[model samples]
Target chain A: MSTWTSDAAALRSTWFLRGVRAAFSLPGLILVSSFIGFAALAKDAGVTMAQAAFMTGTVWALPSMVVLVGAIGSGAALPAAMFAVTLSAIRLMPMVMALAPEMRTGKTRQCVLYLLAHFVAVTSWVLAMERLKRVPPPMRTTYYAGLGGTLVTTNVIVVTVVYAVADALPSAVSAALLMLTPMYFLTSLWGSARERAGHVAMVLGLVLGPVFHIVLPQIDLLVAGLIGGTVAYGLQLWRRKVRAA
Target chain B: MFILVAGFAATDIWRFLGVYLGGKLSEDSDLLVLVRTMATALVAAVIGNLIVFPGGALAHTSLDLRIAAAALGFVGYLVSGKRMVVGIATAESLLLAGLYLNF
Candidate 1:
């Protein structure tokens, strides 16, 4: 019985390796590119290399980190930076909801799942959700683990490369690399939206940010996001009510 | 950097909260839908902010180029039947090419 249990554990680990490979495929590109961008941002912002890597490992949310750094650089209060980052991470709530069902099985699996959730990024979450149906249930967790693990490792590597080449590289190249982070994120989310309200929310945000930035630069993103998301949610609720009626 | 790290750590507190809460929910409830839509909207808002009022290097490029690249990439993603990799590569490639030309 002990030998059988050991064999089962080994098999699970091996399967996890395969799952990681499958999950890592295209999703890895997104993480790697984003890390390069993060590196550039760190360099331009005067953040140390260790600090950047630490941020990636800890915060793991690029945009929010950027906002936090920007806020600090501009001497914004620490509480404000915390609030902004927390607000930025609000999107992860649903992603966790969606992914949790796929990851959690038994108690031990739940522990692993919780650790795996830390690695969830925009790219891997989408890929995992979309591709999970093709995979067996038990292996889904392993695959997600693999994909996210590769991304975390790649993030460190990319950031290191960017830091190494920061002074040597041309400004244009650094700039282009940095843009890839947001570009990849925006494009990925834009591509994956399935609901009309989601699309509308995006459009509203796109239109409102610039308008608000020109008029109320201090809180354009925060205000636009609140207004846009609230409006979309309200519209969706109304539509549902009408349909029910 | 210190603040950003602390800020991120704070953000992650929510992820941990999610794990605890997620262990006890149905995947297809109305509440879930509400959560999904709210999250989607926030993501949309962030994307919009990036494109429309970019800071840093993206601010150097023409708004037209950014719009065109994003549109082209989005359409490509749709045309390619919602393949995320295809969409991301398409948009990034277009923007890079456009940036190169302008420079």
Candidate 2:
């Protein structure tokens, strides 16, 4: 019985450490580098380093943080900035929905899932979805907690340090670093897509994003996503019908 | 304080909702599929906007250079068996090279 108990404890630690270790991988490094750019942007927007670090910790979503910074830079009112950030964060809903089930087991508590859900932004979501299949069901939550906790802590530090020294970095270098986030997103989404509909949605969104930006600059992202995704879904349904026929 | 309140509410509410609803929903449900696709598209739109019409420092670079770098990076990603690091290295290198050479 003692041996069995020890084995279980060892297994748990191994899984949790595995998640922590993943925070040093390419995706994790990319996430940290993106925050370097965010720090620079925040500094340029006149946000204090403390506020930037606070946002990074509390907001946890890079895009939402970006939206908040943009809103602040433009001197947008509180309600408007909140709304914009909320809009950008709506994308996290599906991500959490998709991921929650993956990490949940029959014994997992709802509160535990709720706590873990706070870390369901782009990079964590992508990393968890890609790696969770390798984790046993009972240990998935622990693994995710390790990953999320490390990512949040590490990024907060990155923001703090980078914000303090941002003035010294060249515009070109910071721009190149900032560009890494989107490049990582595009490539990962393309690589991990489960179906043709996802590919279609991505391509349509990419094409329509710039077009809608010109036509309706304010709500361009939302409109492009709605139209692109719906059209992709419709095409998927049609293709299924054709195959069945 | 404002960032704390607004940022937390704006982002975490959906996550809480997802946790609540994820328990009841099936993975392959039609609603889930639609939501997933919409989310993916939304993210894609964000990526497109960032690359094509970037703000802050990225705005200093010309649009053509940014687009070319992204395209080449994507090609490199595909050719490298979808390795993310490879894509990032290609794009960052191309972008910096363009900036330095005044291309």
Candidate 3:
């Protein structure tokens, strides 16, 4: 009956404490800023508390949260908003795939993976990928749960607090806060696009996305990503082959 | 509710799928590379929309100012050794200042 009771208790106490402490450092600060920026953006988009709360809690990826607001505020269809948000999340797929191997051990196909997957946003993935190495392999998931849990809770609280107070603030102040969303995405992305292909993809998308939007306002983002991403991937393969030869 | 079912749920599907698949495949595989590339492109597309065809308050701002802010952000990011907050703050301050001065 108590096969893993001690593990669970230790996880919630020591591992969880370690995770929380790590969170309050760099990762926590970055996440707070990004979410604060996003909360402001959500307010400017006229997103309600319920909507923002849902996005913060579930769509925890700051980029996706920001993009959903942008897509919806532009009067895009429900499907379109979902599409953009989904696209923003594709980045996390590769991330979790890379990181999950470290979190689980043995042939355990526990349902814990599905729960952990929700915590695979940029900050958690990056920090956990690094900090999790310090932990025993068996305890990594618990460590991550603690870290990711704190971030999500903090973001939800920040979103609620920011949105609640936003209405009372002056329009200009709110607008400045709103502007922080793109600024955050652009700058943070600059750090992550560390490779040649990533830079190529980003440059192409930057050039092509707006053009596609101008031509076809509805599905521009999707089309641009397909084309630009394919081009970057192709280029990367070609470069690799050339180096091999 | 919509955000829950569609937005978060939709995104979670990918991560779940990834975990299932990652254990079996090599990261060097073409499929994974292509998917990662697509993700990068989509993010870039979002950035484009924000800088160029953005909705909300940014829509009211002029193109020149937006371009300048992005330029400032890029330089600031590079200068700050890729500190995200530094770069974002510089651009945000610039745009807000420009907006204020314009007003």
Candidate 4:
């Protein structure tokens, strides 16, 4: 009983609270507005409010939600819609890979990792990568939970509220609001670019991501991510060698 | 149910796989760096897709307005001690204001 009490305290320490506090800041706001936008967009695309909220809860990716809703509204085959949605989520693989390492601790069980991975979207993963170093390793998982939990909770509420009121807002307002998610990403991605390699990746992605989407809409994300990332990594390595020489 | 199962499963499977693979690597491993690089790049890709290939009301809005707002937001983040709220607010308001005036 004593050991159990200590473990609980350790997991819910100052770091955990700090994580919650930090998340309640810009990251939480970003997620809330984005999910609200998603709900509105999903509804506009003929998805029911319940379905939009469910997608927001389950898929947790704005692009995938958009794709699924678009596919459904356009009367595409179900398999094709599912396939497109799945393709949009390939980016999460790298995000989860980056997030999983810092989240491991002796106190954390493997089974818990599955639950945590569900919340490993772009906003949470980027903030975690940037801030996890400040946290002690043993408490990292709890800190992550605090942060990821806040965003998810806020998203659920935002999606629900926005879906409920989507029709009342003018199409212009709803349209602009929907852009908030992408706009947040634009700023957050540029703001969070810590290294030259990351910046190069951003520029390349800005070009390649859009171009690929136009050329090959089905697998644009997968193709752009692999090629753009590889080039950024290679360029950074070459620059370092040049500096050395 | 099919959409729920296939859509959720298709994405969730990668998350499961990522946790398994990432747990094996030590912090100092070089492969971890590559993964981080890939993740960052993927984030950039998603952002780009959002800007250029958006599928909803945002898709109809002019690209210049969105780009302008994003520019200001990035600038706001830098100017406001990297405060993400200030940046996003500035950008979002700009986007709304732009839309209101033009449309």
Quick one: best DockQ, which candidate? Answer: 2
Model 1, which residues run further than 4 Å from truth? A1-10, A107-110, A130-143, B1-6, B26-38, B55-57, B99-103
Candidate 2, residue B44: CA error in Å?
2.1
Cα misplacement distance, residue B53 of candidate 1 (Å): 4.0
Best by lDDT: 2
Question: Which TM-score values does chain B get in all models?
Answer: 0.76, 0.83, 0.84, 0.74
lDDT tens string, model 4, A96-123? 7778877787677998888989888778
| CAPRI rating of model 3 | medium
* Candidate 3, residue A97: lDDT: 80
True contacts kept of 2: 0.71
Q: What docking class should model 1 receive?
A: acceptable
Error of 3 at A48 (Å): 1.6
Full ranking by DockQ: 2, 3, 4, 1
Each model's fraction of native contacts? 0.42, 0.71, 0.66, 0.55
Prediction 2 global C-alpha lDDT = 0.82
Which candidate would rank higher by DockQ, 1 or 4? 4
lDDT (CA) per prediction: 0.68, 0.82, 0.78, 0.73
Q: Compose the digit string of candidate 2's lDDT tens values, residues A13-131.
A: 88788889987887798788888777877876788998999999889998778768766766767887777677667767767888988977779998999999988877888889898
DockQ of each: 0.48, 0.63, 0.61, 0.49
Q: What is the descending TM-score order?
A: 3, 2, 1, 4
- Over B1-103, each residue of candidate 4 has an lDDT whose tens digit, in order, gives 6558656786788788888878564533545445445555655666776676666677777888887887788788889987778877887788888887884
Give the count of colliding residue pairs in each prediction: 2, 0, 0, 0
Question: What would the per-residue lDDT of candidate 3 be over residues A1-245, giving only the tens digit for each residue?
Answer: 36445544563478877887778887578678767767767776788888998888888887777677777777887877787778778878778788888888885355887788888888888789788777776777778888888888888998889878876876656666666666766766656764688788888888888898899777777888888889999999999999999
Residue A21's lDDT within candidate 2 is: 94
